[model samples]
Target: MERRILFTIMLTSFLTPFAGSALNLALPSLGEAYGASPAALGWVLGSFLLAAIVVLLPFGKLADRYGKRRFFIMGNGIFALTSLLAAFAPNLPLLLAARAAQGIGSAMTFATSMSILTLVIPKERRGWAMGWNVAVVYTGLTLGPVAGGFLNYYYGWPSIFIVLAMIGGTAFLAARRFLQEEWYEDTSPHWDKKGAVLYGGAILLIIYGLSQLNSQPLAPGLLLGGLVLFFLFCRYELRQENPLLPITLLQGNLPFSLSCLAALLNYCGTFAASFLLSLYLQSILGMTSRSAGLILLSQPIIMALLSPLMGKLSDKYAPTKLAALGMAVISAGLAGFALTIHNLALWLMIPMLIITGTGFALFAAPNNNAIMSAVEKKHYGLAASLLSSTRLVGQVLSVALMNLILSLSWDGLSLQETLLQNLQLALLFFALLSGLGVIPAKVRQ
Candidate 1:
């Protein structure tokens, strides 16, 4: 039963990230097919992330009140359905909408999967279980670019969506067959509608505003409005008996708060690496999608292999220290990329990717263990949700920053030159951002 539950959880974990990483390889193809701009291609990715962030906390709270297994199953179904719809989308608008709906499903699954694992696994083996879970996620990322590239080269970009639908369906079936238990912290019927609206609205406004910074005159206003709404959301949540987020967790718990902050910084710094690289390889260097995907495999392959080992180590050592060390390595890797961007060679790029991947593997599983371990069992769902939310928020910021750079620097230069400049600036900024995370990671209890 334990093995079956782990397998089921792992299957669900693989699907969303596979789609995300794979889509990076497909972006140039997608842009050419739709005659879309770089910002628009960024939206294809950001829309899904934004939607997932909006629903994650609410779904996490709701899963705690209702049942996680139920939401997990529903998420799989919605993801599969949306993938099918996205495959047939004739226009970019329809495709973005479908991807947004898919994000809601991803939120459901992301909010619940780790909580379920934490509930069923014993303390001694918890890190090991989490390790394998993180491993499969890296595995998905490892395969996505290769498979997505191959499919896009042969059958077109729509085939990637078709493959995602099949994977989602398979995961849905596995969950139905293997997961028999339902887990929930409370059986409450009361809902926090106001808190939900404020949280979701704030995230939407902020992300949308950030994405529009290069084009919109009112972007700053929208950003300020979003911050105001977020403040209101936090205040309202503090007053509520059943808040969307557990405010105390952030305010009172040192380890959990710092761990979350480290996660946010790490993701913000690193998540855009692939996005920038894909464009650099294909658009700047004129490599085919297949070739670019193969080159990109160096990072996640190392991550997939090393994550399980790091996870097991976290069981016996100080996870915070491991996480802090990992963040420093990631900063070094990003700095390597920044320094080498002007005259990059495969030998240099591959080594940097390997270093970055190693850092990610070291950081991901242990940081996850730290976050989940710091919280009580009852807040597992919320903790998982918050972790996922932090990741999405960072990812959104990373992409938005990339889009902003691409938008600002595209003038008066060739496309290749523009991309090179963007990559250089972005890598430097990310390296500095990642370096700052080490302090919080080291200080966290």
Candidate 2:
């Protein structure tokens, strides 16, 4: 059962990043083929993330109420079908819609994968198992751009989706065959409809409002309204006999809350670097998609290599201390990236990538350990959902911020010096944010 679960999760884990990173490299080609603006291209990624954020928590709670195994299998099916839909999308709107559907599928997997793993793995060996799991994630990311570049260069962008569909299908079949266990945290018959609606609505409002700040005049109003709804949702959850999300996990738990915040900050600091760098490599440095992908591979490669060792170290040492150190290293790496606008050399950038990757490897598994360890056994699904949500939120904010910066100065046609300036400015902000995250890590001490 453990081997089956491991294989199932590892396969699904590999599929998500394999699709995401590859799609990032294919964005330029997609733009040309579909006549998409930079903002529109950003949405191609943003739409998917938005959908994930909306469903992650709600579905996680639902999974606990029903059965995780059933939801996991269903999610894999959704993901596979969406991959096919995305591959055949005839227009930009359809493609974005398909991506959103894919996000829902991904949310199903992301929300429960960790919880299920925690259920099966022994407590003492969890760090090692999580390390290996995270390693597969990085391995997928490591391969994504390289494969994406080659596929786009040879066949076309659509082939990426087709290939992703096949991968998802394989995972789905493997899970269905080998995975026999059905784990449920809450077997009693109950579901939190109001909490689910309020949570999803608030997320959509906030994300949509923030994404529209560059264009819409009333975007701030939308954001404020969303915050109000979110507060109301929390109040409602607290009062419920059996809430969708137990408020205590976040409200009373300092370690869990701080760890979540750190995760959000870390992702916000690092996620958009690749998106911006991909553009810089192809447009500014005149590298082909394949060559740029090879360069970008350096980061995740280091991450994949270091994750297990870091996970082992976390088991022996103070995870918060290791996580804080990792965040500090990330800040330094982002600072290095910011410094490179004036002197854009591949040599300098590669070292910075290595620094950030190593830091991320250190931060990810250990931080996950801290969050999961802090929560109760029953709240594993919630913990996993919240952690994944934090990541998705950070990613959305990173992209939205990127779009806002680009919108302020860019005209969407030609690459200019201002784009690099905006990128540098963004990196500076990320470095500051990552450095700020270290405060929370230390506070957990």
Candidate 3:
């Protein structure tokens, strides 16, 4: 059962990132195929993330109240179905809808998988398991670009979706057959409907607003509206006897809160690395997708190699300190990318990627270990969901920032010096954000 659980969770972790990263590499082809504008292409990615962010926490609570294995199997089935939908999409709107459906399914899986692991895995070995879990994530990311590029180059972008569907179908079958045990800590009939609505609505509005700031006319009004509603949601959650999120977990717990904040900042600073670099390589440097993928391979490959070691280290040392050091290293690497990427020799970029990957490997598993360790057993589902939420939020913000910059600085995929300039500014801002992340990571309970 434990091995089955491990395999299921690891496969779930791999597919989500693989889908996202592979899509990033396939975006240029997608644009040509669908005649999507830059903003529209961004939405192809953003729609999925937004959908996941909206439902993740609420679904987490539901999973705890119901049964995790049930949701996991259902999610995998949905994921596979949605991938087939995406592959067959005849238009942009259809494709976007398919991606959104896939996101909802992904939310189901991520919201419960880690919590399930934390419950079943012994306390002493949890770190190692978490490390392997994160390593699988990097492994998926590591392969996404290379595989996606080759697949796109030879078979077209739809092949990516077809391949994803096959993997999802396999996971679905494995979960249904082998993972028979159901884990549910909360059996209460209570479900906070109002809190869930407000939470989901606020996230949707805020992220959509952020993405539209430079491109749309009413961005400020949308942003303000989302913030107002979010504040209301917080206040409402505070008063609920069984809040959807249990605001107290964030408010009263120092280590957990800070760890979440660190995770958020870390993701905001780092998640867009591949998206930005993929464009830089293909659009700016005029490299082929396959060739660019080879270059982009440096970071996640290193991350995949080092994550298990870091996870084991977190078991023996202070995870917070290790995560802090990783943040510092990330700051330095981002700065390097910002300062020298354009003028530096192409080969020199590999070292920068290695440094950045190392920092992330050191940070991810340890930070996740800290967040899960800080929470109690019953709140494991919530903690896991919140952690994943933080990551999705960070990713949304990262892409939002990228789109905003591109909207203001470039148009129609035309190559211009300003494109590089805007990208550099974005990298520098991310470095600054990462530098700030170090503080939260170092904050002790």
Estimate every model's Cα lDDT from 0 to 1.
0.89, 0.88, 0.89
**List of clashing residue pairs for candidate 2:** none
lDDT digits (tens) for residues 1-445 of candidate 3: 7877888889989999898888887898999999988779988888898899999999999998888989989999999999999999999999999999999999999999888888888877777788899999999988887788789989999999999999999999988887878888787768899999999999888988887887689987898899999999999999998899788878899999999999999999988877778778887788986788788888888999899899889888889998999999999999998998778368668888999999999899999989999998899999999999999889878877777766555555445677887888889989999999999987763
True-structure RMSD for candidate 3: 2.7
Candidate 1 regions exceeding 4 Å error are 27-41, 279-289, 405-422
Stretches off by above 4 angstroms in model 2 are 28-38, 279-289, 406-417
Which scores higher on lDDT, 2 or 3?
Answer: 3
Show the lowest summed lDDT stretch of 10 residues, model 3: 406-415
